[model samples]
Target: MTELSLRTRESFDAVMRKYADMVYRLAYARTGSTFDADDILQEVFLRYIRADKTYNDEEHRKAWLIRITVNCTRSFAASAYNRHRDLSEPDENAGAEDPALKAAETKSDVMKALLELPEKYRTAIYLFYYEDMSVAQIAKSLGTTETNVKTRLSRGRDMLKEKLKGVEFDV
Candidate 1:
């Protein structure tokens, strides 16, 4: 039993390492701050560790972690912490210290538009387009209906189009 538990712990750690960056990116996208993202990342993993034994299997575990991260971000967004912070200001130095960083920053305006969106729409857009998740997968991960995910995706795309009309992106 001890050996079995040890193996499970190892497996969980391996999975966390593989997907941590993606999880952090999703959190960062939602929160628009490294500090918040880091907090969410830690909370997500902590939840994973405390999860039930039924939370087995790599795919399900990954989805569960993402769902928790999203939920945590949403909760944080609604809290007083978010009320005091300004969401309009983009982090000029975030992931932008090199040439590649400069290239990525070119899309800062678009990301800002995305950040300004309602949380539901932003989550759908990020999961669908940025995270490259399918509607069904997103629905499963988010515990929503596929039709709802599709609706959100459509609305999000329309919003993005409207917001990015005058903006040109290199990529």
Candidate 2:
């Protein structure tokens, strides 16, 4: 095709490579389902390709992607199909005999506890801790005030502490 089309395609590919993992991780953290996360990833990038907005910088582009990913995950979770889907309980076994396996088990427990949290709290915790995003950045990405992000982080941490009381989670 034209040079402009080729350049645009290259730019999109680079953007996808740079942010795909971040988008997938955020989506997975929000939904607690790999399938849903994959679907959201595709949708988020589709939206990115369709958007006509101009980014001020790479950080602005990243924030825009984060916002889109969050919105798409929320919409996907709220869809009638997802609402009617059945969620199977995770296996409740600590069958780890080795140190590495035990560590895996601990991580599994922490993920379970994280998944048990409310959407707002989980999103706040994930963005803050896992993504290394500041409260101000999270607030802008989530379309909330920094105060609200701080409150959510505090409440979410308290909830996580309570949920993982017997576990050795450092978060």
- State each model's CA lDDT, in order: 0.73, 0.80
Candidate 2's residue-wise lDDT over 18-120, tens digit each? 7899999899888766666778999999998888556767778889999999999989978987666556633222242434334434768777778779999
Estimate the overall C-alpha local distance difference test score of candidate 1. Answer: 0.73
Clash totals for all candidate models: 0, 0
Q: When superposed on Cα atoms, how far off is each prediction in RMSD?
A: 5.7, 6.4
Worst 10 residues of 2 by lDDT: 1-10
Instruction: Pick the lDDT winner.
Output: 2
Model 1 lDDT at residue 113: 76
Candidate 1: C-alpha RMSD to true structure equals 5.7
TM-scores across all candidates? 0.73, 0.78
| Cα lDDT of model 1 by residue, 1-171, tens digit | 122222335566765677789888888777666667888888887777776445455566667778888888878877775656575656445554443234335857677778767777888888877778888889988889999988887887778878888643322
Clashing pairs in 1: none
The TM-score measured for candidate 2 stands at 0.78
* Model 1, runs deviating above 4 Å: 1-8, 52-56, 80-107, 166-171
Question: On a 0 to 1 TM-score scale, where does candidate 1 land against the true structure?
Answer: 0.73
